[model samples]
Target chain A: MSFDTELAEAQSAIGDGFDRLFAATPDLPLHRAMRHAVSGGKRLRGFLVVAGARLHGAEDALNPALAIEAIHAYSLVHDDLPAMDDDDVRRGQPTLHRAFDEATAILAGDALQTLGFELCLAPGCHPDAAVRADLAFSLARASGADGMVLGQALDIAAESAADPLDLDGITRLQAGKTGALIGWAAEAGPRLAGADIAPMRAYAQALGLAFQITDDLLDHEGDAGEMGKAVGKDAGAGKATFVSLLGADGARARASQLVDEACDALAPYGKEAASLIAAARFAISRRS
Target chain B: MSFDTELAEAQSAIGDGFDRLFAATPDLPLHRAMRHAVSGGKRLRGFLVVAGARLHGAEDALNPALAIEAIHAYSLVHDDLPAMDDDDVRRGQPTLHRAFDEATAILAGDALQTLGFELCLAPGCHPDAAVRADLAFSLARASGADGMVLGQALDIAAESAADPLDLDGITRLQAGKTGALIGWAAEAGPRLAGADIAPMRAYAQALGLAFQITDDLLDHEGDAGEMGKAVGKDAGAGKATFVSLLGADGARARASQLVDEACDALAPYGKEAASLIAAARFAISRRS
Candidate 1:
């Protein structure tokens, strides 16, 4: 199948998986809010998980995919809180806080995060206990104080600081914020297989940086209606983003270069990593 | 040693464990907020974990104890948010949001929750990978949508309901809110040893109800200065607590009966379980 078809199918399957998961939960307001928060993402992270798993053998990546998506959704839920980003819209719909109340939003975010770990540890996620532990441990590292949250905390602290961040600072911050989970998702297949993750790690690091550059580019020169959220937010806030530091053309060139690096890193996997390569290319090509 | 001494020691050890854990983190506002949030809890849940581990003979329950407390601290941080309980004080100190900012409080809570999972999955937590998976999986269930958060969500929903919750409703809510984590802590030792959880489950259920009853009783009759939190708020809001549903005398009697059940359930452990029995009794006796 074409990469787009595979990605679309993966997204559809993930949506179905979530439907089954929440079907077991009571149709309460908090749960509904959780469902809403998880909905409408491009499912790129979920696709990354499946793509990684496919590079291995017949491992069930569904639960891991769902797990990563749950974590992503939880991050978004908190990020949009009034005290945080305070965005009113996400994926073209009302954010969780706007849809429900703030308390429910916070609870929904917390619960979704727990659900991510629960999914990683569930029996169906992996047959080996060691692999399950590895998944949960790696996920916690990617999400916790030293990883994703560290990046976010740094960014938040910098917002009130007098000096604007230089290139190294922004790179360090992005490494924790967006790149950590992206790297984890990319390595999920190898992690499940107990395979060496060096190649996947390299591929993911390149892809993550490229993805962020593209994101900054989109924010610098894209559309609100197409992106399903506000654009130019970084520039509007006078924040230092990749585009702001590198110039839009420089950012685009760097994204292209990183995409090539991502594709090159998958050389050890031979022809089977074509879709992953496509995913790297798509990261830079997408509008949103 | 006496039960209070043992508990005080456990609290001290857990505090030290947290210090070591945070020592590795960068000294940022978020990490500081997290430290502040976890500092003042009674560590009842952590003590339960250690006590359970002691029964299993030298299981090194410190990691699991820290994990439980981390999760507990995370819950309290969010509970004190302006959108949630909106409390400015917790454990006689300014709440995380009050001490730092709301965004930092939210990030700290999110990171702390992840830290719980990280601690449970660490190799020091258990020798067996299956056991570590079990620790993380059970902790997730206890904290997630189907567990403690479920109870919190239910309580939030009821706050704005047209009618007050009856006895059954309140019982169900408390089961998720307070009872779930208490039960999990009680069963931690048995879970580590792969022993029967039935006795611990029974003990925890009874003790949890007794604990909540006493909490309601304290809120109804105690002083805020002594409790270190606002009292009579449940009564002020016309919320039906155990003391409201069952009058103060009735609540006290019920708590005493539940305490007896908790002690009786520990008959399986016999004389070796004296401290646990004392812990149960202390639940009803404490002023805070």
Candidate 2:
């Protein structure tokens, strides 16, 4: 399928999956919190998972894509909590806690985190229990203490530090918090699809770094309305950013170079990986 | 080994595991929340898991036992959130969010939940990847939406109902929320130990119900100081309880009956199941 067609189909699947997920939970406070946190965004991570899975020969099973996206969504919900980013709004709507209560928001995040794994292990996604287990292990590693949680901890610590952190420190921090999960998504699809994972892992790493660098640049230059969050909040907090360290032009160059590296890593898979390559480029170029 | 020796050993292991868990995330707010919520528990759930594994003829592995307890601890922390029970105290200390900020507590709970699975998948637990995967899958199923989350949703819905709930209603609610995970602990050991699960599952179910019945009875008859948070809170909220339907004496009777059933379920396992039998009895007899 063409990239546009594939993207269109994935979007439809996500919409349907989300509708069922919401229906399953109904209008409870935690359910509402989940809906609020998941309402908008490009679904880039979902697209990447789908694209990677297709490249690696996964069939029409959209469960893997949905599960990966759910984890991404859950992370954003917790990341925007009052104790983390403390944002009152997300994707142009009041954040989960703001819409409900802080406690509800917390539970919603917890539910979604677990739900992601549940979706993966739901009855018939894979015949081999080991695959489901691997998916669970990978997701936990990406989102837990050594990965996203560590990144969040570092982000909290960075917010209060007076000294300027070096580029490596900032990179390592973002790699854990943001990059780790994205990379996991990319790698997960291929693993489940029975593809050789070496190239996919490399591509995912570059794509993840490129995605974050672009996000940093967008925060520096993008419109708040377009981004669904205040653009200058990072600067306001006086935290380190790629754009801050490397300058806007330098950051853009770095992002583009990373995208090129990401694409290069997919060469072994040929045309099957075209959507993934387009996704890497899109990650760096998208307004949001 | 006697229950006391096993209990002491499990407690020491839990103490060390918790020390490492807290130290790993030393952000002051997060650490405080962990300390506040994680301390004061008797680690009964951890002991149950160890005993269950031992009953299945596997030597105690501290990592798996600690992982099970971590899930138990994380659930308590989230369950006490304002949107849920709205309690300010647990085990006589301020709840996680009460001791720290709401956001910190939320993140701490999230991290802890993920940490449980992470600990299970950590290096050196089981050499077989399939066994490790089974552990993750079982844990996720027990704790995720279809299990605990569904029960919690039901509890929230039940709280606002005009009519008093019956014994069945209360039992179903607790079975999912509290019983599912407790049941998971019992079966997890056998699953991990690669032993037959049929007997373990039966024992877990009976023990889980027995524990809830005793809890309801305690809420009616126990002291607030001995029970930790306010006693009779359930009655005050007009939520259903076994005691509400069966009366205090009846609830106690049911608990004893269930304890007998739990013990009977373990009959085929012989002396190997002694600690599990004792733990089931202790679940009903404990003050806290």
Candidate 3:
């Protein structure tokens, strides 16, 4: 199958799974908050999880893919809270607190986070509980203070700074905030498939860096309508960006270089990893 | 050892473990939040955990005890948030958000929660990864929306009510908000010890109910100087309480009955559960 066909199939399946899951618990106001926050994203994290599992020779089952995506979705919801990013919109829709109340938004974020672990720990997944534990641990680390939370704190601190941020500082911030979770999705596949994780980690690291640099480039030049979020937000906020420090053309070139490095890191898996490589390239090349 | 002596030992051990754990990660601001929030309390929850573990025939290890207490402390921190309880003081000290900023409080709560699971997943614990998974899963559920978060939402909704709450409503609210976590701690002992969990669950359910009722009673009549918090705040806020609905005398009788029921539930385990039984009685009788 073509990478596009596979990606579409995976996205459809995850979207359907999430809809059912949210519908199953309709009485919870927090569930509504979660649905609002999660419904409109492009499912990049979900795609990476599905692609990673495929690369490690695991089938794209409903449970694992949905669970990983739920974690990603939940993180975004909380990360966009009034106290965090204070974002008014997400994926072209009003943010959770804007759509609901702040209390509902908080509860929704908390519930969705629990839902991620619940999906992994639910009966009838892989029989090995160790693997389930490993998946939960990885997601927790990615979302917690040592990783995404720390990155967010840095981002907030950097927003107020007068000095220009260095490449290393920006990279470290993205690695913790974005890269940690993306790397987690990739590493999860190997852990769940009972495969060695070294190569997957390498691929994940390169892909994460590529993803962030491309995101920076897109924010600089991409259309707000196409991207589904306000473009030029980083510069307006005085936030650090690869394009700000490295110039637009240099940033674009660096993104392509990172994408190539990401693809090369997946070479050991032969055709099994082709979709993941393609996805990494698409990640850097896409407008949004 | 007598229950009092054993409780003291447990508190000291937990204090030492937390001190070392906080010292180990000095760089993160969240770690400082953990330390500040954790330092003031009487360690009642820590006592319950040690008491529970003793009932299940587990040796008192600092690790599992610390893990459970860490979760307990983190919950208190989050529960006191402006969006949650809006409390400024706890145990005569400023709450996490009061001591630090709201962002720091949020991150600290997030980090401490993850730390709880991380401690459980640490390699030195028993090698039964399934059991560890179960422990982590249980803690997550008890702490998350289906448990404490739900109770908190209900509490917020109830805050503006003029009508006095009935016994059933208070029980349901406290069960999710406060009881579920205490129940989890009781069950944690057997799960960590790899013992049969049936009796432990029974003990936990009774003890949790008893603990909340006792808290309500204490909040009604206990001295503010002794309790380290303002007493009569529940009645001042016009919040529903067992004492409010049942009258102070009825509430006392009910609390005594619950203490008896809690002690009776532990009878099947013989003297091994003595500490737990005594702890249950002490939980009800103590001023704070």
Best by lDDT: 1
Model 3 bad stretches (over 4 Å) = A159-164, B159-165, B222-225
Query: How do the candidates rank by TM-score, highest first?
Result: 1, 3, 2
Cα misplacement distance, residue B67 of candidate 2 (Å) = 1.9
| Cα TM-score per model | 0.99, 0.90, 0.94
Residue A31 error for model 2, in Å?
4.4
lDDT of 2 by residue, A143-173 (tens): 8766887777677767668886679989988
| Candidate 3 lDDT tens digits, B1-288 | 888899889888888888887676646556677788778576666677677777667765455567667767777876777776678878888888888877777767766676777776665555777877887788777877678777776676676567655778788889888888888777878887888777767777777887787788888888877877668878888888888888888877887887788778778888877788888788777878
lDDT of 3 at B32: 75
lDDT of each: 0.92, 0.77, 0.76
Cand. 1 TM to true fold: 0.99
lDDT of 1: 0.92
What's the number of clashes in each of the models? 0, 0, 0
Chain B TM, cand. 3: 0.93
Over A106-225, each residue of candidate 1 has an lDDT whose tens digit, in order, gives 999999999999999999999999999999999999999999999999999889889879999999999999999999999999999889889999999999999999989998888999
CAPRI-style quality class for the chain A–B interface of candidate 2:
acceptable
Model 1: docking quality category: high
Candidate 1, clashing residue pairs? none
Report the Cα RMSD per candidate.
0.8, 2.9, 2.3
TM-score of chain B of 2: 0.95
lDDT of 2 by residue, B1-288 (tens): 877788888888878877876776645565556556667678877787777777666775666777777777788887877666778878887778787766666667777788778767665667666677677667777887667776776677676678866777778888888888888777867877788888888888998898888888888888978877868888887777888888888888888998999999989988877778888878998888
